[model samples]
Target: MKKIVLIIALLSPLFTYAQNKPNKKKGPTTYDLLIGTYTSGTSKGIAVYRFYAENGRLAYLSQIDGVTNPSYLTLSSNNKFIYAVNETPKGEVSSFSFEPKTGKISFINKQSSEGDDPCYVGVDKAQKNVFVANYSSGTVAVLPVNKDGSLSKAIQTLHDDGAHGPNKDRQEGPHAHMSILSPDEKYLLYNDLGTDKVNVLRYRASNEKPLEPASTPFVSVKPGDGPRHLEFSADKKHAYLITEMGSNVLVFDYDNGKLKQKQTITLLADNFKGQTAGAALHLSPDGRFLYASNRLETNEIIVYAVNQETGELTFVQRQPSMGKNPRDFAIDPTGKFMIVANQNSDTIYVLRIDNATGKLSPTGSRLEIGNPVCLKFAPAQ
Candidate 1:
């Protein structure tokens, strides 16, 4: 008995040391927020804001100006620059040198989008080229991004052809609503709302050109679906798309660089009647949830739980957006909070997210801006 007791005491400190060595778990870090805009007619400037997320709180760090209707934006891989679309009649794209610490933007240069009413922009993985989707003109344009963070002249612009819908007011012309680069950066996907199709173009970063017929062809949504925005799963094996006019979501089996329609689901109640459209769609960074924004009647965000194995989406919950007309919204870098830009209400609504359940609650911290059109987030620290 004495010998056993002696051995137990000898090994106790070793066991405690092994258990106490700080379990290698990573914690959260400070995140910075970026803001996109649709500045009112009175102000020619769109802006970006930096918010610090620390200790369960956010603080407006700084703001920058001198942009034109920056409705959507994307950051460079190196985090040194930003590219934004000027959603205006003239339709141009602007590049900037982003000072993350100060949230100050220095205009590098602006290049014509080569089409009218450019609404969305994305950068290729190589960081050498930029793609712009012109909504009104129904075209996609590619441009070169200089090493200095300026934009060169547009290299290529391809006009989409076709229009189909019962509503004459909305489908009279092709409207290229959004552009996204593939994971391999070899293809650019442009979804046209007016035609209810998603066009795939072979993108060449080195040549700063998009292959004609775009090579990959296009995917058709259900008649009158009016696909607005889409997001791919982390593995690039599946995609989720939101139809603006139909107010439905579709899942696709993506393989060999092509998208095949798989399932379609509605986010609305069967008996609920409302005149509205869907605007934006995104997959949560963690890949556990998906979110889509609705406009017009309810002006709320619809959440869906994603099945990782099958790529099917299940209706989770609907949360009222604190503002009206949520034209665009973004999940913060940390995925802890969401900020919505209400175009009609001219306010920015912030929501606290429940990670376990994927529900939302209003934070009541509304930032007033004129004709706020979109919200984006950047890094804080």
Candidate 2:
């Protein structure tokens, strides 16, 4: 019967279509890891690695040698260039052009940081300026970015004049520790470790000197808090600060260039008391959780459940860094693994991330490097 044949042909075509449709395309399985170090020990300079996403492993690729203390690093928005702080008494900033495909970097140029012991470096999205935080001199310098990805001399330097904190030894003078761009890239916030203040500055990418003090000059924390680093929420409505001396995470409601403290939480346990020093804090990729690293006696990653509505944090669980003095950690682009750098132990460890519970478990993967303090992840290209 012709009618029966037509039905069979239609059903056959439908079955073929269903069978030919390919399975869901998989995501990227590899990324590039950039490690910044103190460079005083075995590390030659900045090191690069190829990271396997599926199994959370790392393979060393190449490194730039003979550069002095490339301690803190920041990449341009396009990932085409990188800037690092020399972190010496006569501080300097170095520039390099990066090739995302081959994990190779070429030195471009270097410039004076305009102060002593520059510790942190940041670059604007448009590559117009590179900012440096000078710790010992307590100053912030803005250097113009050359068209060829090099750095020009600092155009502006602002000295921190805030009063010192109560700690006599550590807070003898102002010490600028870090400078971070806001989520929207509209403001620059830096912390003074010796002044106990988080200073916010308005940013304009096109200007020769791109930073200006915000309406609210600085937000004062407890005298001995020693704010070290600050991380803002993905939505730009909240901010979190970790103190180096006091070892507390402070929550704040962030608005147009202003911060209002809301809640403060301690990173140390009640019974275990030795020493406390908070280093770095970061919000998870999905913005559902916050992770902070505590150095000194407690070498652990403290997790917290972020309250989306109220911009507050509830304690999650603590995971050991599996090494000594965890300085900084980076979550892979896929958000499946965490890479932690142990400056004292000279080891880097990878941990598996639980998407559901905001917890971390050791992946048993480790890389041995000397004085690894910072870890950053980018696409392998």
Candidate 3:
């Protein structure tokens, strides 16, 4: 009996030690993904998903319906509200209160976009103003965001009238594609694809008519380049413009709301002659790399090594987007993965980004939704 008792006592400590061992498996770090889609098809409205940053996987969550073509989405600085553009003949901008914990959203109130077919939406850093680019109407409207996160009536509307681009079918008139706020929130810049120019305006929250033309009102690109999107470097010293018609990226030196052309690079191979359209442009969090996506023919992402000192770009590698017609894509806050919204393919592809070389590799995970047009990530609550 003594021998058996001694043996049991020795094993008890071992059993306790095994029971107290730390877990080797770690829980996933999650982020809230908001997808904007075209409502012409089966898609009702914005779809929400939970993205597992640890492994580049997404779990579908609930969605908010009844919105017509919430084609583009932007989140408030506080991450407590979301704003979307109702792309319709009679355009509208809707606001919603976002619950990150539950991945659910509740409709607040919507206001007229002051134009037709609004395509893009952006919120100021102060969260006091919301901006919409009316693509069909060739106007940009500034709407005040109420304290409760709803949108008030548009306070000011700026009409852009200019010479049309060379492409008569697509660029017959001013088509404002995107409206973005400068890093300091002191200026607003918008691209007019039809006019092939970027309009810069000074923004003041306290003023009655907040948006005024900047000293350098506009920067004109090549006649038919069709500047679609603009992305500023982390230092705010450089800007990159993605041209839809030409399928190229243009580099610019930015200073005090003025842009000077630096360089232009093609997004395709020298010998590959096919229809190409540049869609989206994004810079890595570290500002070491730049990524731009080409739709239609190529359906690939053009990677570039950014010269931090001079803001010049050197071609890196082009990787397939893994789906068709990548209209928009976003890099997660951690910069570990990129999610591409393939509008025509009805899918979203997850690609792992190599931090060392800025190259992309497929993670083999995809989300199926009807005509996913825009992707936005909010930190998990």
Model 2 / residue 39 / CA error / Å = 1.5
Taken over the whole model, the C-alpha lDDT of each candidate is: 0.80, 0.90, 0.93
TM per model?
0.90, 0.94, 0.92
Q: Per-residue alpha-carbon lDDT of model 2 for 159-205, expressed as tens digits? A: 77757889999998889999888878888898999899998999887
CA RMSD (A), model 3: 6.1
| Top-TM-score candidate index | 2
Collision pairs in model 3 = none
lDDT of 1 by residue, 302-375 (tens): 99999989999899889887778888888865667888888887788778888888888887777777777766
Query: Which candidate, 1 or 3, would have the higher TM-score against the true structure?
Result: 3
Specify the poorest-scoring 10-residue window by lDDT in model 1: 49-58
In candidate 3, which residue ranges exceed 4 Å CA deviation? Answer: 1-28
Clash pairs detected, candidate 1: 31-380, 32-378, 32-379, 32-380, 34-376, 34-377, 34-378
Which of the two, 2 or 3, has more TM-score?
2
By lDDT, is 2 or 3 better? 3
Q: What lDDT tens digits, residue by residue, belong to model 3 across residues 31-101? A: 99999999887789999999988899899888999989999999998889999999998999999999998
Rank ordering of all candidates by lDDT, starting from the highest: 3, 2, 1
